[model samples]
Target: MTQVDKASRKPCIALMGEFSAGKSTLANLLIGSDPLPVQVIATQLPPVWISHGDAPAFRVDLDGNQFAIDLDNLAEAPLDETAYIKIFCDEELLLQCDLLDMPGISDPNMSSEVWQRMISKADGVLWCSHATQAWRQSEAAVWASLPPDLYQRSLLLLTRIDKITSERDRQKLIRRVRAETEGLFLQCLPISLLQATAEQDDYDVWLKSGAEDFAKHLVDLLHSLSEDGAVGPEGQSLPEAAKPLRISGLVAPDSAPAPPPAPAPQTAAPQIMPRRVRLSPSPQDRACARDGAPGRPS
Candidate 1:
């Protein structure tokens, strides 16, 4: 396929969830490096459209105008008037799919319009709900409005599963979310974004952190999108010119096939650990916490 065709065909997977749902953390983990500014600054900006390339950053205004931007000074980009900031990188995972790091759905400081406007660009969604507060009413209400076709393509992630601590609580939380979002998502997985991103050098830690299983399913989903004609937000088919490409470092060497149908609720629950819950700003959060930028509401 030609370069332009390949770019158009690359499946765009949006990372969405409430504020502090670890969406940014997951983005950094998948990309194998943090390309955007720290979360403090990032959460305030428009949807960051990340794709596979080496081109410098630029902002796409609401009028479809493209203006050169300096990543170091991303704060200067007017969030109110911009459509989305396009960030290009050469990450391997990005070669197979474009990851749109969307702002929190319920961000009080930012309007819903910011993310709503970009929904049309997504082929699928990786919705990250906090394990402690999985599937809130607001989240459910918003998700209910999404295209029905996307329900089968979307994956609901109960992030920060490690925070639940007890196995019983973890199982209960998973079961509850599963029941509440039945048929609304392809599958639900409990994961610790912090653990997954921190255990890069240790294969065992990486697998145990739930990244392995997540990666396997994600790759399979991308492959499926490439083969099938998944429709975009506008009810138009997304581009499908390129063949499926293997992501090098994200999936484990011996990753199992997409997790088998989840076992019956009474069976031994999956041994996925809950994620860390930080009341204070994390190092990353603190990095952008300077200048009294509005903090992400819990």
Candidate 2:
């Protein structure tokens, strides 16, 4: 790949949502590990973590010194002065993509400046809201302030989808939230992060939580971003070509291969087709080929 192509290949997706929007849960699901600390109680601190080899989670202070973390307790760790903590995991799927599991956007205890600085480093965002009370005006208003570049790459996820018992309620929230966000998001998917975790063994859970659709959507979005050449709001090129889902580091090494048998395999091989090309010499090559004009300045 050319340098320009290589520059466009790095895929980074940031998860931004209100407190306890299952942001950590979603990350766990995608990574196939609950190793990430998740709880209803607000242990809200910026864990600027990413996945790779099963490296240790180190406390990275402002000076960039690395200290081992307890994983059970990050609260005691200082965040205001610390640069960020990096958690390395065996999940190879993250190699191609870097995930920024950011803290809540409008937390009273934590200043916006904390998350805002991280936002500047994101390539795209996954904004999760609780399905029970989704797409709140506060969420919309905050999302509105995001620049158009962010808007184009952002996706809204209505988490805790199983909370809505009735199908009527599901459709209602879907339509309602869709209307509110409209064109702001590339896609908005309703997911039951809880159910998804519970039925991790069951194939139905993936579809039920809407992760199946969400995964497909994410693949398309990541590919589009790669092709569009807009890595961030700054319009820097993204790194080499990749289908986000198939990325090496984002998923676990021993993760199960997908169940077989589709009318057409979803992981279809790229089709090659013959095409026409002009073999004629250009003005720049006139000295060699004479531009194919009879005796023209050979």
- Tens digits of per-residue lDDT, candidate 1, 1-298, equal 2334434466789999998887876776666566776644543778888887899999999999999999866767887899999988786567667899898898889899999998878788999999998999999999998878788888999998888899899999889999999999988998887776455445576566776567656766786776564443333554443333333324332223335565657766666543221111111211000011112222
Candidate 1: where is the Cα deviation over 4 Å? 1-8, 39-43, 200-204, 229-298
Q: Residue-wise lDDT of candidate 2 within 1-298, one digit each (tens)?
A: 2436435545567888887777776676555555555442457576566756677677777676878887667666786876666776664346546677878776788877667665656678989998998988888887877667778788899988898899998998899899988889988899776554455345555447775566666666676666756353234554453223342112111124445544655688755443211111121111111111111000
Question: What TM-score number comes out for model 2?
Answer: 0.70
lDDT of 1: 0.71
What lDDT score belongs to each candidate, Candidate 1 first?
0.71, 0.63
Give the winner by TM-score. 1
Find the number of clashing residue pairs for candidate 2. Answer: 17
Error of 1 at 154 (Å): 0.9
Question: Model 1 RMSD to the real structure?
Answer: 13.4
